[model samples]
Target: MAGEEFEYEYLYKALAKYANEHQYPLAQQAYEGAGAAEKIHAAILKEAANVKTYEGTTVYVCPICGYVMAGDSIPERCPVCGGPERQYEKF
Candidate 1:
């Protein structure tokens, strides 16, 4: 999962650069936001790698930015793009 997150992080960062060069501000923002989250995810996944047990862990995804959150609960809004709680998908 950490590897995947890192990979996606690279992709998102590249896309953000491309979008910015192409003058697509919205796309650039989305990509940058997601990229930031992916980096965070990589670290989080690394920390969780040694854990063998699982519990009532909830997952939330910000639809607008592709930001992911995994834990007992998610924040009221996405820290990167500020996506509201109602806009996040739960799993």
Candidate 2:
């Protein structure tokens, strides 16, 4: 059972790599064998569950360059891409 789980983990990594490399068919195959989109969704949800949500501090990421910002108000400019406050996403 442990070995099977390890194999699935390996498949997950391979699938992610294939996806990054734009081999969608290979990635889809691996992802399906590893339990498909639900598995990925569950993993994301599980990781998100562990995060400590802050009510006071607003966490934002810049859309242009994925620059992260934490504050009550948007920054004047994104540190990574020089994007304006409107380009930031709040979480």
TM-score of each: 0.65, 0.39
After superposing candidate 2, which stretches have Cα over 4 Å from the reference? 1-52
Top model by TM-score, which number?
1
> Per-residue error at 2 for model 2, in Å?
25
lDDT of 1 by residue, 35-80 (tens): 7877877766776787775567777888887777888667898899
Candidate 2 root-mean-square deviation in Å: 9.6
Candidate 1: residue 10 lDDT (0-100): 75
Worst 10 residues of 2 by lDDT: 32-41
lDDT of 2: 0.59
Look at candidate 1 and tell me the lDDT of residue 46: 77
